[model samples]
Target: MHIQMNDIYKAFGANQVLTGVHFDLKEGEVHALMGENGAGKSTMMNILTGLHKRDSGKIVIDGEERYFDNPKEAEKHGIAFIHQELNVWPDMTVLDNLFIGKELRSPFGLLKTKEMKALAKKQFDKLAVTIPLEKEAGLCSVGEQQMIEIAKALMTNAKVIIMDEPTAALTEREIEKLFNVINALRKEGVSIVYISHRMEEIFAICDRITVMRDGKTVDTQMVSETSFDEVVRKMVGRELTDRYPERNPNIGDTILEVKNATRQGVFEDVNFSVKSGEIVGVAGLMGAGRTEIMRALFGLDQLDSGEILINGQKASIKNPFEAVKRGIGFITEDRKNEGLVLDFSIRENMALPNLTSFSKNGFIAYKTETDFVDMLIKRLRIKTESGETSAKNLSGGNQQKVVIAKWVGIGPRVLILDEPTRGVDVGAKREIYQLMNELTDRGVAIIMVSSELPEVLGMSDRILVVHEGKISGELLKNEATQEKIMTYATGGQ
Candidate 1:
C-alpha cells in the first residue's frame, strides 16, 4: 500500500463528522470515495491535506509515519490536492501561476522568465493540453482552469494525488479528456484518490470503490466486482427506484412566457413557456447560457430586448424587487453568496422577500413573523435548533432548504430554481424533489436549471437543451433522454 489511514476521528464540537474512518491506497490504482453531503468526505480530504487537525487518527505514507501541520508539509512529501473549486491566480499568466512560489531563478536568484514559460509550455504539451502559456488564467473557462490545476499538481511529480469532483463543471468531451489524463497518471505509477457523487463516473474510472455513510466506511471493493446498484444501496442505505417524482400528466394554461428574448451576446431569439403546474428543466453544459437565461428572466441581469408575459398579461421586470412583486421567485445557484444571509437568523431571512406582509403600517410584528417562520420551518422539515439560529450554523442541505423555504414564504406564482440541489445530499434531494411535486400539484410553475442529467430528465415535464447561448433543442418528458440531451448540448448533428 502507498498510503494508509486508520481510525480517523474528527468532530466539530458535538457533531462528529468522521468516525473511525479507515482508507488505504496503492500505487497505480484509482480509489474512489463516495458519500452524501456533510458525510465527512471533505473533512477527511482536509485532514489528509493538513488543512484541519484530526481529533484522533493515524496516517501512514510510504512506510513513513508523520503528522502534517499544514498543506505545505504535505506538498513537501509529494502530496497534492485538486479541489472542486480550483485554486489559480486569475490575473496572472499560466507560466506565472505555475511557478508562483517555486520560480525558475538564475544563479543570482534573479527571475528566469524565459525558463518559466518554456517549462509551462512543456507541461501543457506533455499533458496534451493547448492552453496558451502567455494568456491570463482568469480568462480561461472553468474546464480550462481545471486542466491548469491538474497540470500544476503533475508539475510537482507528486506520488499521491487527491481530486474532489474535478468534472463537476466540465462538458462531456472535457470529462473524457480528464479521464484520459488520469489514465496517463496511473500508468506513471501515481496513486489517485477520486471523490465524486456521479456513480457512472466512479464505475467508469475508478479501480477500487469505497462507500462511506454517516461518517464511517461501509465497504471497499474492487470496481470490477461490484455493480452500480449495489454501490448506490450502500451509499444511500435504500433503493431509489425513481430519481424524480412522476409528473401530474395533465397540462394547464401557460403562466409564464418569453417571446423573442434577446440578451445580445448572452442569448438571443429565445422563446419558451411554462404552464401552471408544469416543471420545465433547462439543461446545458457550463457557460451554455442556462443560468444566464434564468438570471435574465428573474431580472438579475439586463436584457437587450424581450417581451415577458405573465398569465397572458405583458409584464415588465426591471429588477429583482419588481420580479418578486410580480410573484416570481428565484433561488440562485450560488447559495452561500446570493441565496441566504449567512449572519442573519433564519426567521429574519425568511421574512426578507415579503417583509411588508409581516408589517402593519410600516411597523414590523415580531410575534406574527415568528409564527409564520415557525410554520415554514416545520413544513420544510428544516433540521435546526431554532428559527433564531444563524443560517451559517446549519449544514449545507439544511441551509438550502432554508433558501427554498424563504422563497416559498412569498407565495410565488412562478419559481425559477438554478441548481436547486447542486451541493445538497441525497436524502435532502429526495425531500426537495417531493417538495417540487407538491408545489406543482398546488398549481405552481417551476423552471429549473440543473447540470445533473438524471435530475433534468427525471423531474422535468419538458426539457430544453441550451447550447452556445441559444435553445438548441426541446423535448417532452417522454422524449427526453440522457444521450439525446448530450447530443444537443454539444451541437451534435
Candidate 2:
C-alpha cells in the first residue's frame, strides 16, 4: 500500500501546529519520523491516524483520495497504531485484552474464548515470545506488554502500522526481539511508521527519514543518503555542534551524602556523595535499584537503614515535604501520574511547588504566580498556547519541561532526575543538558538516573552502575563506557 499526505495544515485557536507538512509511506518499508519536541510530529501523525481532522490537506491512498472521520474509520482502511503509552489494563488477562473491543463471537451470541486465546497465542509465537494467555496484562514486564501491543496490531491485519517511541521502556534484550519482529513484519510486506528519538534506531531500522521542525516538514531523505549529523541539524533548524553541552563542573564541597542506604529487597548499602556543581549519573537496567535509591533519598520510599547528610550535617527526611524544605527536589520517573496534574493549567502546575513563596497569610498572590510562570515558560523554552492551557495539552517533551520547571523553582541544593530524557527528542534533550549545565554552573548538585548508557557517559561527572540492589561500581566521567557500565550493571563487579 502507498499513502501520501500533501500540504497538511492544522491549528488550534491561535497556535499553528502543522503548516504545509507533507508525508508519505512506502510499502514493505519502515519509515522514520524525526523531529524535536513540539516539532509537529505527533500533530501530523494524529491527523494521519484520524484522531484529528486536518484543517487543510489531501490524503491519497493507493492513488485514491480519502478522508477518515475517526480512528475506527481509519482502521477500516488497514491502519493500526501502537502508542508509546501502554493501553492494557492490569487486571485483564492477555486473552481478554487482545480481543477486548473486537471479540470473536459465535453467531448464536456466545463468546469464543478458546479461539481468542489460540489466536493471541499464535501472534505471540510468531514474535518468538511465550506469553501466558490467561495471565494478567499488568503482571507482565514493560517489554512483554509492548509485545502484546504489537500482537494486537497484527490481530487487526493492518497493512500500515505506526509505532511511537516503541522502545522507550524496553530493555536491551527486549529491543533486539522487537527489531526481529519488525523485520518479520517487513518481510510480510507491512508498512511501518517508526517514531523515536534514538538516532541509532533510525539508522538501523528505517529506510526513509522525514524530519519536521516548528510544524513544518523540513526534509525526507533515504537513510543511506544522510548522516546522523545532517538529520539532527534539519530537525533542530540549526547545526548542533555538540550532543552534550560543554561543562567544566567546579566540584565544590560535598552537598549531599548517603551512608549505607538500604531498602529491603530494593537496594542495599548504597553509599555516594554529590558535591556542589557536580552531575552524578546513575546507569543501570530496569529494576536494578537506580530509581529505588533515589526514592529512598527523596523520602518517597521507606528505608530500612540509611543516613543522609546535607552540608556535612545529618538531616532526617520523613516525608517529601521535609525533603523539599531541606533543599532537595525530585523529578519522578512516572511524569503523568506522579509529577503533573494533567487537568491543571500550566499556571497552577508550575506554581504548585512555590505557593508559599508566591503567597502570604494563606492568600495566593496571582501577580507573583503569573510572573514566575511566565519566566519559567521562557527559560525552559516551553511551547504552549498560553500559561492557562492544561498540562495535558502539551507534547511529551514539553510536559517534561513543566515538571523540571516546577522543581527548579523550588531552588533545591540537590536535584534528582529519573529518566530525564526518556521520550524527549534530541533538540529538547540538548536544551535540558544546557539547563543542567546552567544549574551546575550555579553550584547545585544534580543526580540523574537514566537507562541510556550514552547519555550517562556524556553528561555525568561520575557514573554509578547498580546491579540487583547493589552499587556494582562507580566510574569517573573519562572512564565510563557502554561496555564498562554494562559490565557492572550485569553484576560483573
Colliding residue pairs in candidate 1: none
Segments in model 2 whose C-alpha atoms lie over 4 Å from true places: 91-95, 105-115, 125-147
lDDT of 2 by residue, 268-290 (tens): 89999999999999988876878
Q: Write the per-residue lDDT of candidate 1 for residues 1-493, one digit (tens) a residue.
A: 3888889999777677889999899988999998776677878878988999989989888798777899878887888898765678989998888887989889999999987778788888776778888899987766688788988888888888898877765666678778887898899898899988777888899999888988999999999999877887887788877656666655699999999999999898899999989999999987898888888889989889989999999999989999999999999876766899999999988999979999999899989999999999998777666899899867566778889999988989999998888656565687789999888888899999888888898899999999998899999988888999989999984
Per-candidate TM equals 0.88, 0.94
lDDT of 1 at 473: 95
How many steric clashes does model 2 contain? 0
In model 2, the Cα lDDT at residue 312 comes to 89
Which is the leading candidate under TM-score? 2
Range of the 10 consecutive residues with the lowest summed lDDT in candidate 1: 242-251
Using alpha carbons, what is the TM-score of model 1?
Answer: 0.88
